[model samples]
Target chain A: MDDLWYSEYHTPHVRFSVKVSRQLHYEESKYQKISVFESPEFGRFLTLDGIMMLTERDEFIYHEVITHTAMAVNPEIKNILVIGAGDGGVVRELGKYQGIESIDVVEIDERVVEVCKEFLPQTSCGFEDERVHLHYQDGLKFVRHTDNLYDLIIVDSTDPFGPGEVLFTKEFYGNCYRALTEQGVLINQHESPFYEEDAKAMKSAHRRISHAFPMSFVYQAHIPTYPSGHWLFGFASKSLHPQRDLKADAWNALEIKTKYYNTELHQGAFGLPNYVKEMLKDE
Target chain B: MDDLWYSEYHTPHVRFSVKVSRQLHYEESKYQKISVFESPEFGRFLTLDGIMMLTERDEFIYHEVITHTAMAVNPEIKNILVIGAGDGGVVRELGKYQGIESIDVVEIDERVVEVCKEFLPQTSCGFEDERVHLHYQDGLKFVRHTDNLYDLIIVDSTDPFGPGEVLFTKEFYGNCYRALTEQGVLINQHESPFYEEDAKAMKSAHRRISHAFPMSFVYQAHIPTYPSGHWLFGFASKSLHPQRDLKADAWNALEIKTKYYNTELHQGAFGLPNYVKEMLKDE
Candidate 1:
């Protein structure tokens, strides 16, 4: 009962810790180590490979930002593909949109889904939705082989390490570009710009995606559980620009109540800090 | 050094850890325990009462945010009063403006100033400026008695606990309201809205200040060393509105080179998340 603290090293010299009341569940999945813990502050939270994935208190922000930004951009979005969000939080957010006809989630690990379903029902609730098709396979391979094109593709993978490393490759980005329709918008979890390792990944992802897509940009969000609490998401598309093409009025008409994502903040989030802008520019 | 990790309990359940290479110094002043640690990631970071005050790596965002937002709104600000910024980070930022006439800093703990001067010179350099006047006294008492009026007042105090608890009181805010000129702007380190305790403080500060000032608003910044990485600052003024009265061109004409704060972000930082907006709203 004493000294039960779960800590994750954000960098070699920086770490984040949470005092665990008890271990709810733990299993070394084929892909990584999946564990769930109960805490008074964050509530029941899940971690994959010793890193925080989602917590009950803050999961809404991450899920809402990842899902609603693209949905708001393309109100007519029908088909969507989600990569590596096995917790089903992304699917839960997409389920809110009645216009979204089909959602294909490509997760590398099935254990993440099963464990989340058992221990974390809040984020896993939308897995029961009929439109959500769960494909337990590697996301890198999924984007390469999938014949059906999607209107919006969201890559909700981990950092560019371990199993998530392939998801950031130029080959994978090219495949995502090809798997998308002409008007398709590609968004991925670009790493933070503060730390050295993450910044390198961020710049590399931008370089690759910028080459594949005609119009590409990076937006930022404050996700406390992540490293440095400053997180970035990449937006790349063939034609649509986020600011110019953002139909704020049209999206507001949907009246989808969100905790974090708003039409104005959507535009504001894209107003990257000057340092981040410098990092994203071709060097 | 192998097992040396400095951890701060963000909440009862959540903690943040940094691998300390060595302890720079430690002393218990009349007010609180002040300690400095050297780490590879954050360089030398200072902590008060076992809580992180600032780190060398991310101190720019905090100092830039606390000072420039108000300065940008009121470009004609000349006489400024800073309360509780003993580290001199706020003064260092104010030193950038050549138009600044006199900068008065009121701090309760002389130990914080002396220790930071000996160790954290990057932030303490501005203390040597001839225009900068340092007062090693209680900020709450200084504002009550000082007859001089200031165009801008920056409250760079710590969280509303221990020695900082008095700085967030209604009486203290009323004193600040009196000490300010007709067009003066008051900005304070409003607590984060993510955690419950900090959210309570944030709401209380907003409610009290909103009642005191004719025009009041809350702006946000992403400071990772902080509890939630999402931190807030209160902007209360006698007549000036941050957005409406913002002289972006005037501020830009000054050509103060900054790494974080900019005129565009001066507008964007006020765009709070939906939940934060709800928290700030009168209940």
Candidate 2:
């Protein structure tokens, strides 16, 4: 156990790893590789293709920010369409809201959902809620032709590669824009901005979202498990503003206890560094 | 060359590494082991006892925040004291200010200053400033018995272990408090609050500083090379509130161009997550 280390190369030049006490499960599904490991520091962590996804220790930060940021801004969001979050972290937070009417989850890999239910109960508990409807299919195709729509669309896919690669394309974003209500919000995993590759992906994603939506704002959060420990999320809407239209007063009245998300931090998260702002600006 | 990698264990169970082109320098100074490596992603990086200190790519984020956070709040700081930043990054930023009359840098290991000046000229350029004075001695001892007064004291020491363990002691904080002017400011490299061991150090340091200073506040930044990429800095003063007494208008008026440090982000940095606030709480 002393030498059992699970390593992932964040870049070709940079690697991050944790000491594994034991490997709980490992399998290759129809889409990609899935792994569940129990570690001393991060507790139980799930990885896809050897890339760290979520840990029992810090997944709250990612789950809360992704779900609550848009929910706070648009309290009128009656329906939520979650794309590619098979682990159920996003829905777990969404389930806390009594106002939301229904949640439609489109996950390409059903094995990820099944495995998470059996392993990561902390995040998978949301799957048990009756309000959540699960659909196993290609999210890209689902968005391309869907009669059923939502007021909020959350793109919680993996990196801009593999099966998740299609989710980042301008076509998928355009389809998502068409599938949403007139006044809808789009939130996606915008990747990290530190390494050259991740930064390229982040900027490209921002640009594509901008083309597909009337307004787009990129915000950041500290997720040490991710590459560079700095991760970005893109907020795009048809017409609503994240700040000027922020319903902080209403969100605060929910009294929903959160570890990371707050009205104050929601304001601060958009106050990104000048360098990051420069990178996001289109030349 | 294809397989060479420079690795550092952030915690007992976590390991981080960079693919190295070559080892630039490796030596055991009178104080500790000093090594430098060239990497494709991070550019050039310096390590002490296998701990990554700074990389050429992201050093600006650390150096800028460490100096500018205090500088923005108190622009009247003419005399300054820096402890243990032998890399000269702090002085490099401090040197940008035209009002800074004198800077006394007390680093225990002169070899670090020498090696940095020779190999890492990007950060070591400030050593050439005539207003800079280097005092090679134990910072704990120097602060305990210095008649020299400073308007601001920057504790840029390493982690609270080995040579740096003393700097985190209540005795050292008390000495720093005594060595400052009536309205002087104190800024220190407070450890991160993510990993168990680092969180323990960070909490203890905050407690010690709280005991010594009249006012103490903690702020965070994203530093990917560190243990968790979520790094923090301690800001303590006699009576100045970092937010209330914040001279944002004055700091903004300076028009000092920066890559990371900005007034809006400064105000936002103090908004900590609830989990972090709970960890920093005194029972």
Candidate 3:
């Protein structure tokens, strides 16, 4: 990897990118980079974008917040399918539940998974977990084939304009609806609400998801290294509203060492501002 | 004023400025840079180390969470003084209560006030209000002149290295105690908790404030544009423990347009990660 640039977003977290690995196995894309570093406290890091998407210590926050929030609301969540989680962070988090029978991860880039297994072992822990299974295939193709099976589906994809763009479209959302059971829940990593276009894209995605699912909503979290230091996640469920009134003690019993996503934060995360609420309504 | 850099914390709300004014009207400082820009939707933007710190659109989340949490616990609150609040966002928020009698804003840079008034009028509204009296002077000197007077004194200074360094010292905390009435509350804007040195400085300041006052504590807020998205504020009071069982109606009645600060958020902001809470206990 070569030709890298680092921009100081906020203090410790610097967003940087290097060239695609010379041994890169994936098809060429407009912009793709391979970079790795280690933080003093967060351990090893690997990001698809120049942006530091997650620290090794805090990756659970994004994965758990998306997975568990839906799982808690949809108590019958047994079969889970994760889309584009090449890092395996989502699958790792999903494997925590005792009730979850099987978890399948569909990733387009086998190289990302291979790299994670070799370098980012912490994130790749899901691959080794007995309950988890990996499928090196396009998420869209996998979701289209499945029918009324998965109780929870998580789309942990990259930015919308990249290979992940198809996942944000109406067609993919329709397939997700078809792939889910009546009580199933789907969560996606939406773009930031700070920029107009990102917000618009998220709102559009939310509208499409709402059309397919009974309930859909957006929530926010502070990812310091991300653009504008804030990011939003979109959630859609067939029957559940995604708001769980349970205490942290109920979930803290699992004893996950998460830097951010606590039970108290789970509820508080959904408390949107009037502006965000208005935007959702406008959608 | 010449060679100025104005940082808009919120897109259209608050902006903090560092201006090298030709004439030194109030005091003989090398340059005059004011702290706290409390414009309309832009809550409070503080300038430190020639850099501007802006929170999300929700300024009250940081300001109210810092000020009110301490103030609410201290039942006997009357006179208050805010240091370096050129934007008057804190003062405006403080003005909401009938318990607060007179509020004195001690700002060193009149140019900042003028700029805020001209550019960000909503923050300047604090000055126009009858309860707030403007004192264009040094905060350190002003604190030195009094003993057990103010019920609450908010050190809304910039970063610790610049004009704000004095505000973060033991002497300044001692002066604050001297200026405060018995059972008085004091809250100061500390720097990013992510930076060890800044956290150490804040912890030291907390220790000093604890020595001067009976109780001292630190809390965090998510300010997107700050060095770290997560920033900490130190709170100290002679008698109060800084916890309030807030009624829903009371919390809801605060007529501030906030994107983040709510009653639940007010409590949640104090809930720190174990690492941050552990850092506060260091020697």
Candidate 4:
């Protein structure tokens, strides 16, 4: 297929469809759409849920910032769980650390795994590694049975609608809290801070997560495909602040190519604006 | 009026219309279309040549970072020039200093000034100040007749199209270099770094600006209305780098109710990722 069609929620009733020269297929069982497009810079483009989610050029930034921030903070991160990471981008980032022995990825769509293996080979490299275990099931359902078994859990789902809507609720966060070890950490992708409604919803979700966990914070990144270009990620941990002192050797050991995330950016990302800091206060 | 209509250029051929609430009619004279709308949380919105541009919330972030960075570097600044700031937002930020003696505003469209005065009252507040001198002419033409005089020259034009296209060219930047004092500064609003095409264009523009000026750098801000949520501003100075020792008392003394610009942010704005720093390395 030369043409791919998809829709994004711009507002409450505003949905826009964009067409691009690519091949896209939807999996009924997973209710997820996987797309593949040829690009010069990143090699191949992978998108989910009708959005151009990640490209070959800068996937490391999103994956590393989300995973390492929590993992580095809690030193004893052995067993981890990644919820809804069908592309295996997070798993690829998580696999970099020798300390992480096993990682379980709960993806609603099995076709996403198949498509990633075929089209986005670079991101699918994690599946070949012995450390990662793939589980084809609902993330919310998987977490209920697995309690106090994980050191870190990352909710790498799409927008808070359809299959991901329950991921943003307090009940799911409570389940995630119970599924973690005493010093575990949880990170979820929050929407744009530019949209007042979305920001408020994300803030409310963060509040619920904070009530369940001891420490919670929000950080942002500039993602072109998302609405408002700026996207937020909420971090919650049982005992530690997200900011961890980077060992000189470990900081120098990162080998992945990234356009947005770096040792400097890792520090700057946690430094929030006074307004955003104020918004997250007393939560 | 309850319903207001305006268009935005996502791509060269892709134009989207935004329906707002209020509109100030500008008599058709020089430009194709000019109007101002009172948007929610976006502040005073300006539409020119059928393109919706400039929202209030983050406008100061762009203007302040561009102006203050250059101004802080220079020990002595007497005269300044602003090109295409129809709403006088940059001028408002410029007028914050008691040291600035005079400001000349060269705007091509008189309709934007009138619309801003009538509808976007807050943005037009700087025009009413006695220190500001408004001139109705093209910035390119205005700069050619001027000699080396201004301490600071800010090119606050829109994207590189329509009447604002010349502002992005090498010839215009050469003219600006000639129009500035021996130890002057020049700043322009470049496109976002998120989009590779726009980022390349901005890097090209930076290369041209570097040829005329001794030092050149690029910084970014998060503006939602723009194509990418992240926007870049290029800075060129003759004698000084854009870093300055900000006096907390002096900055706080300027009693401006700013939504974004602050002392800590001023320093933080220059902190770029390894990728951004790498992009500007050879340029």
DockQ of each: 0.72, 0.78, 0.25, 0.35
| lDDT (Cα) of model 2 | 0.91
Which residue runs does candidate 3 get wrong by more than 4 Å? A1-4, A8-52, A55-60, A68-77, A181-183, A239-243, B1-48, B53-78, B95-100, B109-111, B114-122, B147-151, B170-184, B205-219, B235-244, B281-283
DockQ of candidate 4 relative to the true structure = 0.35
Q: Write the per-residue lDDT of candidate 3 for residues A111-136, one digit (tens) a residue.
A: 77777788777778878889888888
| Candidate structures ordered by DockQ, highest first | 2, 1, 4, 3
TM-score per prediction, in order, is 0.97, 0.97, 0.78, 0.83
True contacts kept of 3: 0.21
| Candidate 4 Cα deviation (angstroms), residue A11 | 1.1
The CAPRI classification for model 2 reads as: medium
Of 2 and 4, which scores higher on TM-score? 2
Model 1 clashing residue pairs (backbone)? none
Instruction: Please rank every candidate by lDDT, starting with the best.
Output: 2, 1, 4, 3
lDDT of 3 by residue, B218-260 (tens): 7666565565466777777776655454344554554545554
Docking class of 4: acceptable
Model 2 per-residue lDDT tens digits across residues A119-213: 99999998988889999999999988898778999999999889999999989999989988888999998999889999999999999999999
Q: How close is candidate 3 to the true structure, as a TM-score?
A: 0.78
Best by DockQ: 2
Tens digit of lDDT per residue, candidate 2, span B1-283? 5689988888888899899998999999998999998999888899998788999999999999999989988988899999999999999999998899999999999999999988899999989888999999999999989998888999998888888889999999999999999888999999898888888999999999999998999999999899889999999999788878789999898899899889888888888888888887861
Number of backbone-clashing residue pairs for each candidate, in the order shown: 0, 0, 2, 0
Quote the positional error of residue B124 for candidate 1 in Å: 0.5
